[model samples]
Target: MTDAAPSPDIAVLLADDHDLMRESFRALLDASPGFRTAGEAGTGAEAIRLAREYRPDVVLMDVRMPEMDGIEATRRICADPDLSGVQVLILTTFDLDEYVYAALTAGASGFLVKDSTATELLNGIRLVAAGEALLAPRVTRRLIATFTGKGQPAGSPRGLDEITEREQEVLVLIASGLSNTEIAQELNVALGTVKTHIGRLLNKLDARDRAQLVIAAYDSGLVTPRSR
Candidate 1:
């Protein structure tokens, strides 16, 4: 006897004004299993409406658009209590520190450049859908440096002193842009063990996401840039 077919995957909403870009993204998402387009919107207002109506598991938001930009739409979507679980991932051409800071502050789970590969885009959607923050380590570092004035780290150095030795070690690696798989290999620990450490670090630092954690790492001097 034949086996039962798998259930359809979580729905996704693609929001962007550009027709060609939207079509391209839709095709890419369609090629991936476990995901289907709930709908598409060309404006921020429409994006917000569809999100509330369809309640997609994830949203692909472009940073720049006419009428209402992606940033405002993200903020509105996240603010709605009913759409709490809907994850927003920003896809744009610029990874400017300003956008990085705003997106993270607005509760975006991930940020990516438009030039990223289809594989990267698919992975980012999955990661955010799984409730993980998707931020490139280098971008995170730059955001932290800018927020803290780069010339000097913020907060009392002692603020992070409370973190255990192991936790600090993990933060350094995280700020350095290593994913769980990479960190596990580098530290000789299991993947599950690395996740546990990261969870602990997030709590100890009172961080909202990995992007914020990277900021804390720099502010606390746990990670520093090389001299000019």
Candidate 2:
């Protein structure tokens, strides 16, 4: 019997103050197909250095690190004009309302409760790497509600004017939690085309990742999450 060849290599950096958690995530990510643990850090400062030196494709960060904290580190990481392609995924034990919104706005590609299974973890990393926002439909709606103040109109109505019409359409669906494949089918365009549009949208919007895009979509008033 032949074994499946590993997936293409994905460079990963782990940042967590908790040694156990760091080791655990490192093992899970290493076990996943096509993933490599480039480095691990116990604080936000270390995370920043490893991120700059290793330049991993994805960084699994913890929000409560000492010194800089994950949110600040995330902001710095995403702020780097050179490392625009690197994605940061926040992993935390607590899904506190405050932290969730802050992390996403701070340029995290997504936030995952620490209880997530290995499969979910790997999938989240892959999705973020593929330039997709990791927020679930429900989570996205909650974020919109929290930041937009429930129908009070998002930031300047013209904030989204920078995005092209096609890019706007893609942003709307993305904020709605539709995957690229789903968006392609809904828009009747090729999947690769959808990806290209998303990439351009991110650059045009000055968003670091899909999660930030979701925040921008809501903040820019491009799309409103319906109220129940």
Candidate 3:
């Protein structure tokens, strides 16, 4: 009989100040299939050290930590050319708007509230490890509000002068929180076509993922938040 192929294991590093929380996360991840604990750190500095040592695929980073905070750690990890493949997923109990924006700006692949279900957490890790941005709906709304609260008018943003009009339309739809499938449906095109446009958008804007593209869209005044 032929043997089945082995599932890919995702290495995760847990960085939290609380001992219990770290233990819980380790247990949860270890119990789940296709995931393994790389190591655990009790402080941001230690997290950075272990990241350099283990080069984990994803870091479950707590927002608040001793020695350094997760934001700074994320920034350092992302800035390091050696750790470019390592993605940081910010885990925090607080849903403060500042933390959300700061984490993303510092290059976090995603953010999750501590109260998230085990399934949600696991899915988030997987999404981020696969080079996708995992922005929660609530978090998305907050991000839009934080920027558009300034009451600035929408205008053309830089880096968009190179893309075609169709690409621009796709980007605006992306900033509006539409998935590729939804975009394809909305544009009356094939899903593959939508993905092609997204790829072109990413290349033209020099964005790492959809979340960064959303930020750029807002920053460039290509999209604005609807007034409540």
Candidate 4:
């Protein structure tokens, strides 16, 4: 008889200081299908070591940890050429914590509050593992507000000049918190066309995902909080 196809598994590395929290997360992730616990770390240093060794598909990183903290660890992981495929998902207890935006700037794919429902957490991991940014429109607004509130200098738009004018419009809409479907409807274009524009924007801007694209838009001054 022919052999059945192997099930796809998403390797995950759990990084948190609390034993109970780590254990709970491990139990939930292990019990879920398509997810396997590749390793666990009680500190940021350990997380970095285990990540280098396992090169997991997703790292559930806690923002606060001994020795390194999730932000620094995420920066290091993203800086590594060998770990390019790895995606870091930040975990925090507060939704409006200042560190959330910093973690994103440090190259995190997204953030999740500890109190999120089991379904939200699992779907978040799945989304990040699939190379998607998990920011919703409300979250995007909060991030933009945070940036402007801090009076952070706008980012340079040096790289953005490479894209076509239509792609520039799409980037601005993305930064304005519009999803592909929303952008398609607003621009009166096909959904496939919107996706194509976003894909090209990612390539031209050298952004990893939509979250980075949003950051780029703000940094480039293409979309400003004042304009929203």
Most lDDT-accurate candidate: 4
Candidate 3 has a TM-score of 0.89
Error of 4 at 205 (Å): 1.0
Error of 3 at 43 (Å): 1.7
Collision pairs in model 3:
none
lDDT of 2: 0.80
Candidate 4 per-residue lDDT, tens place, 48-90, comes to 8999999999999998888988888999998889999999998
Q: Each candidate's TM vs. the true structure?
A: 0.80, 0.78, 0.89, 0.91
lDDT of each: 0.79, 0.80, 0.85, 0.86
Evaluated at residue 165, the lDDT of candidate 3 is 93
lDDT of 1 by residue, 102-152 (tens): 766676777888888888888888888888889876555555555544556
Which numbered prediction scores highest in TM-score against the true structure? 4
Per-prediction count of colliding residue pairs? 0, 0, 0, 1
Cα deviation of 184, candidate 2, in Å? 4.7
TM-score of decoy 1: 0.80
Model 1 regions lying over 4 Å from their true place: 1-7, 95-97, 138-162, 218-228
- TM-score quality measure for candidate 2: 0.78
Candidate scoring better on lDDT of 1 and 4: 4
Q: Give lDDT tens digits, candidate 2, residues 16-108.
A: 999998888888877777888999998899999999999999999888988888988988998897778789988865446567677787788
